[model samples]
Target: MKKLIQFYLFIIFSIPCFSQSFSFEWTKQLSSTYFAEYIWEIATDNDGNIYGATDGGGIQTFLDTTFDVATSASSTVLFKINDAGERKWLRHITNSENGSIAVDSNKKVYSGGWFIGSSSLPPYTLTAGAGFGNSSYYTTLDSLGNFTSATKVFSGNSFLNSIAPVICNEAGDVAYIDNREFPSGFTYIQYHTLTKKNSGGTSWTKAFTTTDVVPLYIDPANNLYIKGAYTSAITVGGTTLTNSGGQDIYVAKLDGAGIYKWVKKIGGNHDEWLQSAATDADGNLYISGYFNSDSIDLDGIKLYAELTENNSFVAKINAAGNYEWAINLDSNAYHFAMNLLVDEDGNKVLITGRYTEEMTLGTDILTVTPDQNIYVARLDLSGNILSGMQITFPLSATIYDRKLISPESMLICGTFSGSVAFGDSTYTSAGGDDGFITKINFCELPATYYADIDNDGYGTPDTFTTACNMPIGYTNNSSDCDDSNNAINPLALESCNTIDDNCDGNIDEGLIIATITPASATSFCKGESGILNANTGVGFSYQWKKNGVNISGATSSSYTATKTGNYSVLITIPGSCNDISDETSVTVYNKPNATITNIDATNDLCFDTSIKLKTGNGVGFTFQWYKGATALAGATSNIYFATTSGNYKVKTTNSFGCFKMSTPYTIIKTCKLGESDSPNLQVLIIVLVALKCQQPIQLLKIVNFGNQSL
Candidate 1:
């Protein structure tokens, strides 16, 4: 048996939010081709997959699969789809009203709602008390969309009932709020119960008194938070709070073990309603709603409502359940702050709701048509509006649920009449209001970026757009010649890939180098030159280098090597593509010395006498003796004997085939006078052949001293 508890009721208000630069990635429409379906709520799993719970159902087609929903007015439809809008499965819960759906960290989904008479969820069924009796039931399914189990929580004699969304934390703990009724004496008494099912399948129930208390959220630590409006005094966990105005807003917390933590009440002299609440990773709480009170007190801080109609307000509370700050959004007409979500770090908060006419927050004004306007705004934890945007529909539209996939991305679901634009495409409803889910990205002052399809840091200018901060698969450098290949970028190195790896116009230009003409080492004698030519190609430029340094005036295909060093040529193509050929080592040797000397030391001799002459240092050399300018016959040896007088010279050629000429040597025709021939000096014919003398010639004036005749 379940224990009865008091109930607290809170009224929900609608308000407009702020504005900012918002871009939609995709939009999905859900409804029958001929019938209308209103998407009441949406939830996401850890994989970013979405689950929707709706009523007033119809059929829908996603991808290649078709889902034909039941036509019952009370039939509840539950469908699952991936983050990219690809449908997975759809289920029909017959004889049941709409419900709220949620997913745990493990992707397990839970949903709870009311059903009339006899309702069934496949193999599981629930029976009411009698005629028109309504019962609250909770059912769970695995991530694959298979029903696991169902439990009947409460049954009512009448259909008048209220239920909150089923929420689960990462630890698999689930909680929800439901109205339980029992007969006291005559009529049945209505009571609100808070039910918690732990991961281990343990269950606990607690009740609240005289107010509309709905289970708002459950944090990762399994802490449960409930919010509603209370009049006069309200008590929780032995602590009591007295209202400061007609109806005050209150939020209470319970630990995973069902122990009360604290309760916070916020109000003014007039009525106030709390529409939505959310918590950050640090357990900090942020709430938003509308207050008609001229001024509302949040802790010791005071915030005054704007305009004569209901004004929207958003506030923050620390982990200790203490108020931090509160601010009001101004609008001349009725406005209500509907939904609020905060980042885990508590740095940003997003609020979404409906507004009429115009609404302003800080310096931003969200002006919409006279009909219901949907506004979204982002604020810092300090309660300052960073940016905002407004969405308008020609007829009527409402955003029922929103989930923050990250600080920069969100998923929103709702129902709208008429047509709505998503990105560059427009989608119209099928007859009446149609359910829709859209994914939007929040960006900070976007800039144009090109698509780097190859992810090479360089992109193609052919595909570009203004989008979020350095979006994935995009870059600011648009200099890639081949966007399909990562190796072909502006900064890539030239290789043998045949294509222009460095984005240069020429393909494999520098890589194809012409080898030096004489591929092997070459040698030449001193004072001689060697001609070296490079293999030529069309449009090819050349620069010759010596000893690894560029040689002046050596820019042709052929170069003259006049000195000894390592030589190479730079073969180039236009557009800075070039390569240096392998070095050709050159060696130059000195020609053998080519001087001639007299061997016998006798240049003046009589007839029939001869002298010998030789050239200097004759190793590895070919020598030739010359008379005047004519080559002497048989003078090719390194040594020569001169029998006649004439100007004589020697020419030498080294092993390297280089030649050098020596100075001329001369032998004069002369006679040496003997003692017996000196008497008749005037008519004597002196024969001085083969004579060796210290002095060769002398005047014969001694005739009178040797004979006495003159």
Candidate 2:
């Protein structure tokens, strides 16, 4: 019988198993294209069309597989794309000197630039008017590549060195930096704006001005942030102005109403200009620029802030305009940082720059030999240099401009010394400093996967086969059954056998059972016992446990534990089968305690009061007084009463005890009809009266008993 029972348990524990898998590879490089003149910017539109802004080739458009240059003499070549990576476009301002490009959500391109010529066509005739003020224009383009409107946003006799435009809001309002000449002969940063209605009109409002020369950025809240170099000391908007050196990078934050919130100066004695600034999701500002630290440490670090003459520097500033970290890359004396691109993860920044090396002649004849190699470096968000790699192409001339096309690619536009080999073509320098364009693609390899099957970083030599069965003691990777145990093999179903058929260590581990008991039941109070029995498997040991601990000396088919607690039992067959039944638990709750006591109403009595109220004398007892169904405030003592006639009761509760109430008491207010009651009696009456009055009176007293005096 025991052997038969063991076999029955083995048949109950058997199941199936499965596995998981994966793989990868790389493709060849795609064909590349070349361009005439140096490229300043390469941006990809939503549809994957590549747009290259070249110095001499106007705007080069590579659309739908064709590489062609758009011949527009007025093209300044500023490119930007939408969030979806589609709708590639370039901003061009006619009759203007130099300009910058910005795009809005409506796909409208906003171009702000200086006008150099008087002619309305190509080679816009340059008019030598005021010192630096003849070229300033603003134009907007629609989605279909048509110029919706053009307006001379700002025109002055003073020279406008730089113009930066930004969309301030979704309402089509734009803000830009206008570097107007100050009366002190120093250029100052001025804010200008254009409304939605006057897209073509030459109407603009001068918002604000600062004693600095640089572009300003407008945030989502319509606040303005400006960064640039300042010379003379001038106070603007209550902020004290101070310069670091010849030209130090200065930042100013303004409110929506063009009011200055704070101004910050960063850098040392050397010339430091903030080239670009970006804000993170947390509003922390990141500014990058070239710092020539010759005498002072802008960021306090000699390597990062000190002027190394030729090395370039990048620094990160937090939202409060405080320097967080900084790093210096390379020792090339003529290295210039052009642009910074953040990776998709936003944790790393890619910086692109041009490195130039100078060559020396005889004793006193030192010539500047320019290597003009393109260098790119990846840096952590904290400004720590990661992988700094440079790719130098031997060109006959210098590389004047370059821009990043993608996180892994860049378009280098510069005047090559001679014909240069690009992707699949060669770009020849147009005679005297001809413009050249080339695309550089950097490929990243896939990461390898590793699995530690033996609990080590390395793997072991384990043979895998297609067989469905294997010899005893050997695991067949494909089968979930244990061949070593006849009772646990897949052939067994459910006959109460006891064995690990699935190769697992335990017997009947995965078996299931059902149990039923009285849904609603009761048990005795404290110090009393009750019986709890389960209708389960036979021959079970019935070792009862409570709250996960074994109940000493309590072993029976049913447990009679006196104390209340969670109870469970384990059943063991104790035979060749050695099958252990699953443990089941039941919770036992202790009954509430009960007690009774009486209250002394004599000394605590009120005027005209009768009947007695009481409380329990139980330990940990607390009392509460109720008058006509309403509990009285501060009445939680062992005794309680009222002077007037009304239903009164005393409630008492203790630890492990249920709340109990005393019999209701009745009190009546009465006074002598005629006689001036005895002095002693009157005194007692007055004291009781005060006690009754002390009872917190409800706002609306239902009855007003007649007042009497002795």
Candidate 3:
């Protein structure tokens, strides 16, 4: 018994023991030496260059495959990379102000946000002004790092927060979101503008507005979609939509003409806001945001049972303003949802936020944690958490935003203290709010499979194998039908003619099959037809039927149709069917003749209008209408018009006989008098009447007889 037990263990752990393993090594950092401060954002440009935004130190630019900084003196800069991820550039403005950046199709950058002062000078200084109380401004720049034009598009005492622009039309036009302060309170609205160039240079025209515009996205059709929260009444698509709770996320759709199509609000009684929105290649809209629910469970954590600031949730919304799925991220405490980025596959979403160390359970107990650590989590398209990874830096390090550099790479930017990894080397930031950038490259080593050859999970007594060739006892082992034939594997299924005989659920599935189906025998009015059908099973489906009745879905068979007017059936099936059987039909009826009759046109005999002739069952017959001796060249049987006062006749000929018929009809034309002739004709009639008077006519004077008539 002891020997048998040891032998069983060996068989279980043998497979995993031989599996290959790989290790990951960090690369060098890429940044400048000027005490990199808080890195707000990191992006790779079109030429594969790296660019990062600094909170106070401006922007840092990197070259191709180099960790050394190329340039590092851009103030209030927002870095951008093209869709190709090759080139990189920065939208820099002087005097450093808060703003958002967007790129158009032509590689032009449009930055809109609040600026401080005046809009003069080369770098455009923003000084104190009337609307300079943290008001918003919009500017445009060319691809060559030159300011094309700057415009103070919006101005107000209220803060213009969370601005996003999208290239909605091919004309390089953009639609954006802006929040304005009303007398009552602050209200978020959407605005759009188009650039036009006349003889006097370029100009902009204000298009339209929408309410609660936070997240803005434009589809390929130039349709604008916005999401945000509104308190008071706001008009969207010309209809006023109201929000119930204090703060709610509202989604509004607009047409290309700047007309609102529909507006939908999503949120509970508490504060809910959508942080990011994107459109897939299929034009499906996806949005991610935080929801404060009173009753919900997230990741096995209870939330919202009591009023607590820590209850926060993450959710995804579809294009139709419907929730795809919602996942509660924090149940005990408040977790802020910052930014959402989609990877290349577009099937996974990356959510970045800061979760406090404080926890609240049954009571409002706040743990005096030092700082909040930034957490980045990956989720599937369905809002299911795939992996939750957290990077905890010192309290001074503030991660502003992060983006996926590639499927396996990510770049994070924010404020950092001390020395932080940039590329290959560690870069120490200048204390007091410096910029910091970090790049993480993830290498997905090939999968290694370990089988329980010895029934043990440990590597002991187990053999490991590469995914390509799994060892025996593994799930993939069943793929090797003839283990002796090294070539006989899952990959070799195409070369074999047997059905996944390899147990891969694929039959000679990939192998081509030659099908041979004999042409179906033509059916006679009454006779036996010999039908021979054959197929090599290469790619074919055959079914033989007699008189439209399938012969039990038979692939190869013959049938006879004795009595029939027309008999036919189909053969070739799709997908697996390559050969098709010819459609055989036998006709037994001769052609029948049809004739027309009871034909009429216009009103009755009194009315002078075109008339028609009727015919009866006279097949293959031709007709000709005649007016007196001349035949109406354009006239045909069944209908003839009387152009003159005479009798109309129709002559028709068929295979049986020729027939002729006539109908009496009259034609009358109306005449009208001209203006000049009307006056003369009236005078002539009056003179003629005067001469035809039989009695001596006396000039009758107007007698004013009120009571008696004279």
Candidate 4:
């Protein structure tokens, strides 16, 4: 009987694998004759295209096309496939090891690895400087799998390049970190050489000291993170961190200009290797690996690994190099290679690795039958394991790469032998260990819902939870601005309340209250003007109105009323609210008529004679008399007397508080007593003036010498 992998086995031996919360959709097996080894790395572009880098020997069959490796050594093979598992094209790099692959935002593909001896990559051949060590090689290809640039090789004597881990930014700036081995004193030292090249062909390099380093991710901000294992103390960015016994794991971050941001270390008294890492959209880092130590310290929280067997662990770190949480699986088997990936939305973390014997994942115990030892787990951002499952291969299997695809699916590529079962479908290898790519999906995880307290078909955005079904008092909509009121939602009508009824960040929108200053009628003379002011607001447009019509060029908050009319203003907020102000009646009245006339019409009035001046209209008018420019005392009447005046006028005021001035009436001193004809006559004139003549005295003919009547 064939050996079986038992995941929480009960009494039955033919039971299905530990019930998984996920199911396999499809699996594609790449058959080969001479054993297509590891599927090193896998990447995807925005166009849903999947690219894989692998190593194989001799002839390999990809879809319907067979490709030759030419040499007997393991050569690098890069292939492209669509989202629907359709192979597009493949390239063979002879005599190269398993390489790394990355797809930039521009859909440009990058592939690199270390090659021994003379490796041929199409028209470009890279020859090693020496016949012993390895030299790094890198190349680029367009989205359609066509070569866009010449293959570049890096080789020198001081340092040796091993595996090339490459990445690129949106601006087509390419950067890679290659493992460099060199001799320091009598001992051989290993580190990483980080080379950055921009589109302008400007390039620079930086060195990091470690035992081995792997470049895992480059974020959208061009910040890169590298994970490695170091045995001794290493200084980065002026901070020195000493290893805590055995081989410790270190993660470091560098900006686009190759400046070290920070470096962190995690380890225990025994050995720990960080094998896989991933970054979220927020630049938070997630790493997974195996440790043979009894306990590993992650920033202050410790996880026990049990010295008897190797265990797998996962941890999360913030962008500022702060440890959030860490967790480990209780397993007695040796976890070798592992791959990790965070979902595109950064909600979930997926970890895939190979393990032997038995492993304890959370509350479930999974026991593998002999060689069937593949584990896949899903975890939340808080380091809580959601689900765990195992993929059983009768012979051998190693998952090297895992990616998250569209429509909530996981695409994993690896090498498996014998017959491997993926849910209901099983794939058998053609000869040796064949390369495989499988798409898996979660069954039905709980989804988050918000609370709808007012039953308004909308829910509060802040209060939410995850559940398998819609919880009572909860809904899928999260657009309710006020959950306590049913009328305050995204669909609610705006009113005069000081609140954002439509959840659009505006208060009382579309229900404008137009108001005017004074709020009363303005009274003025016909030729005079009165100012009418309306309410002012930011982003508000105004149009003044005379009665109910829009006044031309009256687009201001204040309007000038020149003529008698009902004045108003249209206040508007463009695309939002508008209103017309209450009518402000403006009464423009004509001035009261005041015409002065001389009653005693004479050619010239004598000095001692008086004249009466009357106004044209005296009813309902108050009059004032003026001599030249001086007002006569006690002249508040409809008529005035002119005794001896050069010019006289009357001012008439009506009940409407409007006053008018009549034209001036002139009077001349035509006749006068002889100044000094006789002293006695002058004395008589003086005596008459002293009497303050109450009545006008008719002047007789001038009598020279004593009072002679004329």
Candidate 5:
């Protein structure tokens, strides 16, 4: 039997995979002659298309011709298949040792690998990438597998590019940390450096004196993470990291611009080789590798590794790069290759690898029957094998690749030999040791249901349950306006609320809920306006009314009342839940209206004679008299006297507390009395003088000078 390897497990394995969650669904194999080669990574687009990234040799299997030409790879390759396995398209990339694959939001595919350029036509000249020259290659293809951009990168300096993994973020920013072999004095030193390039051709490269750096992931935010093993001491960003003798692993976190955020090491007093790592949607990392040491330290915690063979171990680190837990899987079997994947929800982890002898997890152990058999396990975040699942295929499996189709489903691809049984289905090798793709659903979550004890069309808002399906008298709706009454569902009309009047997920909401903004009576002066605002509950419309009549065009939260009346509002809400707001009577008091009505002025009478004027009779109100526009001094009563010729008016008061002025009446002085200039007393004066004029007779008809009478 051959070995088992299944997941680069990054791309769509965004979920956390648990060891006990791996269940065999259906496996289909395409024939391939060569095995035990090439590292694989896979991803899927929004359209459910599956694409695999890895180098393959020999004959490629076809799912009845999924793609165009219908042929496998003779060299480096990118294989794609539809979600239904109805079609496929595989392209032969240049000779690449290790490669990575990704899909952008635009469905554009990117593929790259380390070591470019052969001695022939030159592998760099044949490869494709966005920014390629000679040493490395990067290529892009449209959603339909049409070639777009290609570039091969070549080195001109002393720095050498290691076969580190590459990552392409959702923004299309490509990033990697390749080992740079530079000569310092007599010997060539090995150090790692991170390089990042933007789609617009902007680039930045940062170098560190660390050894064995493997770039793992680039988040959509362009954050990069690299993992590797170290021997001695290495300094990064001026901080030196010393291993506990022998070998250890280090992980570096960097920003999109090649700026170092932090670096951490994980290992012990032996040898540890980091083959691969996968991150959940939360950025929590799950690393898969083999260590030959006796005791190793994970973060600050110490762990003991089984001493017999090369034991494969998986460790988990939080987003902050702190160790959470680690487990030594298959300590008895020598590991050839392995892949790890974490579900997107970060709750489960799936590990695919090869082993011999036996597999022990917790209390459950499965022995490899006869010889070497492919092993796949599922685990939880706490590193416990999930219940009900343990898979060990009969044939040899290696270079595993996995993509999570959803939170509950996963797609696995790898090369296998002979015949393998997955669940109840078995797929035989098409020809030689061929590659296979399997779909698995290993998730279990409780379903949510609403309680409907009354067997009504709706359920009570406060009651619920969890089950795989709706039970008897239970529904998926919680919008029962009344739980006790079957007539009161979401379709019921809202009425007066002794209980829920309408089944709109609310009780007595808009009904009987007419809140007035101004809670009491108020007043407004005449010629001014008053505002009345009604508080209608949510999702309610308002119509304002004056007295008993609805005011035209007065539909809103508040109404501007131009006239005096009892103001109220009617709120009409959806579901026929309506209410009439409280009444707010606005007393519009009128200003004083004063009119000068009965002005009894003795104006056109005797000249020099004072005239008495009286105001017109009116209700209880004070009055004043005025001469023209100015009020007469001390003439604050209902009557006034005019002693001189002038235009005058009197003001009267009414019950409305208003003042009114009458029309003005003018008085004039006609003439002044004067003594006659020459009193010509005729003879009667002499005789009357003696007689003393006692008879009062006197001179009648005395003639004065001119025509003046005396």
Candidate 6:
């Protein structure tokens, strides 16, 4: 099944973007009526076929026959043409000849504006029955120029007023703005109303009372963006837009539910008004407007513009309303921007406007052949002009709408008088003021050649990869005087001590060696910071390096050396004729100034006592306590405890990772005896036993040891 899903693209008449090459393809003049006629807008589909809304006789009648507007007073026409300027089909729908047009992804065309008398065309039939009348009409046509649907918006009771720029995001999801004057003073104050709807029958509408409104756009998210001109301070959606001066431009954004997001006012004190506004795929808004003020304040950055006449201003505002960039296209006499577009990536920007007299773009000044001319410029998103041209035709012409059909082609349409010039060929007008379709073809970036300077790189506007990728000594890098020398490359470091360090083909351009006092001592304590001073000289820049590596932010005349290493200062005058100072050797002594102090007051060991030795603590210093020739286990702090005394000392390492040991101190000890060693009683007992034995021997002769008892 063919899906009915569709998307309506904001047709931006795109020119050759980054590629500075362009040429006119073909031009075809269109006409259908003897009366004054014009094509208001143009668009293109995926196939590159040209389509637009016009009020001329270029289309066929309702009966599928060629239109003869010779008898009809005025007619509204929608047209489609091939790349070769050949018309595929034309449809005449109404008599009232003013409206805007848009296209969708399926190549379905939509044309809307104004019409009088019940349009006899299908779907545009009178809402008030068959009768001569006026109304606003919106019609859709397929790629084959077949009518899909037509809608008569309003008729009978009220004449169609003014239409704002219409935004149709996709099929069945469209948001449009229009204004009707309310009953007020002698002046007609426009009260603009916005109507939003989707295919699912969701609908929302909002009304803002303002001076006048122009471009209205809808982003992919269905958020509505509006542009209008105001005379005084007016508030809309609870946000106030104050007039900067005579007239100021007002822009506001609202969500799908009609909720206000942000409102911004632009312009300062002179008369100004924006013609149109568009959003890139990322929702960054690009606005084109004309101003007469000497300077325009974009958000806060003030841009001084030459207002020789009315100058055109193109601005880029991010989604949050932050001003990115803006510039003034000085148009000599009068100018008005018809359209503005930014590619999806927000890199390439196309601006189309009508200017009289002459306009200077970058270095190219273009003077129109006669009266006014149509101009298109390709610029960066920042409004920097890269390349542009004067797309012109004799008499007067201006492109109303445009679309980039391909990378190298554009579809443009507008009304022209007399004849339209397409490069070498010119096509005369079919009748009165006829509509026109033009094709502009572009080519890829032209090949560029650059000389490899210093045999290292080539000279091109781009970086090394873009233009110098080809095999050779050629490079895309630029401005090399010595291509044969490898030291002449742009990346080569220029030094004041040597000649031509930078490969820019200039010698000693900015070389100025600075003279200063070197440190008296190359060695210092770990906590000490070494000072390096350079002498003052004219036309010199200084870069200090440590061990051949550039020190970040070390560009001053004097440098404090924190770490010990080989230090050198590269000094060069204006041309980078660098004169490097002799490299100085600075040694950092990190050994712990580990001071081991015998904090113990007592040198002699007493009963069951321990002593602790002390050492002063400092940065990057860790100490280990020792006793004579043996290291104390688990004694790594500045203080150590000695359970049993011996020769004691401490070892410490400083910031430079150096270690030192302290002299040893000794502790003396003396032990006393106890009372358990007595033996007097045991000897006395032995003597008694010996005596008894002797007595027994004697008593054996005298009463059996009676003497022993005594």
Residue 97 miss distance in model 3 (angstroms): 1.2
RMSD of 3: 31.9
Please write out the lDDT profile of model 3 over residues 1-710, one tens digit for every residue: 00000000000000111111211112222244442433443434334444443323323433233222223332355554443334354444544344445454555656654445553325665443464244455666666667776666555554332233322333455665444433334553444333222112433333334333443565666666666566655665566656556565566676556556666665455566666655555555555555665653322333352444534455555556555566665465566666665543546666666667553322223343454454556666766765554444446555555555444445555555566543224555443345545544333344455443432222221445543322334442333444444444555545444445343666555344333343554332223333444443334455655455665645543344344423333444344423334445543332222333335554243344444444443566677766666778876655554544455556665543434444534343332222334332321112123366687668733322232222
Model 5 gets an lDDT of 0.62
User: How do the residues 40-61 of candidate 5 rate in per-residue lDDT, one tens digit apiece?
Assistant: 6677777787777554445554
Separately for all candidates shown, the number of backbone clashes (residues 3 or more apart, or on different chains) is 22, 44, 79, 2, 61, 37
Mark the 10 consecutive residues where model 4 has the least summed lDDT.
3-12
Candidate 5 Cα outliers beyond 4 Å, as residue runs: 1-39, 54-73, 92-99, 114-135, 155-164, 177-193, 198-202, 207-210, 275-290, 306-367, 370-388, 407-409, 416-434, 440-710
lDDT of model 4, residue 451 = 91
Model 6 alpha-carbon drift over 4 Å, by segment? 1-23, 57-65, 128-133, 156-164, 170-172, 181-191, 329-337, 354-375, 378-390, 442-710
* All candidates: TM-score: 0.65, 0.44, 0.44, 0.53, 0.49, 0.54
TM-score of 6: 0.54
Residue 686, model 1: Cα distance from true site in angstroms: 18
TM-score of 2: 0.44
Candidate 6 residue-wise lDDT, 112-139, digit = tens? 6555655656544644323333456566
- The predictions' CA RMSDs to the true structure, in order, are 10.8, 27.8, 31.9, 15.8, 15.4, 22.1
Instruction: Write down the lDDT that model 6 would get.
Output: 0.63
lDDT of 2: 0.46
- As a TM-score, model 3 comes out at 0.44
Instruction: Write model 4 residue lDDT over 1-710, tens digit each, in one string.
Output: 01111111000011112333454556677777775556767787778788888777767776667877753677878888887777898887777775777787788888888776788776677887763466788888888777666554667663456546676656677777666566778876776777777655777777776455666566667677777677888776676778899988888888877788888888888788776666788889888877888888988988875444578888899989899998886545566436676765548877767777666666666667665566767677888876666655435556666676654455777788888876566777777778877766543464677999999889998898664335557898798888999988998888765689998888876677788884334887767778888888778899888879989999988887878888888888756567888898888878998887667767266643777777766457788889899999998877777777488888888877788888888877745554665456552243244656688778745543555653
Instruction: Give the higher-lDDT candidate: 4 or 6.
Output: 4
Poorest 10 consecutive residues of model 3 by lDDT?
Answer: 4-13
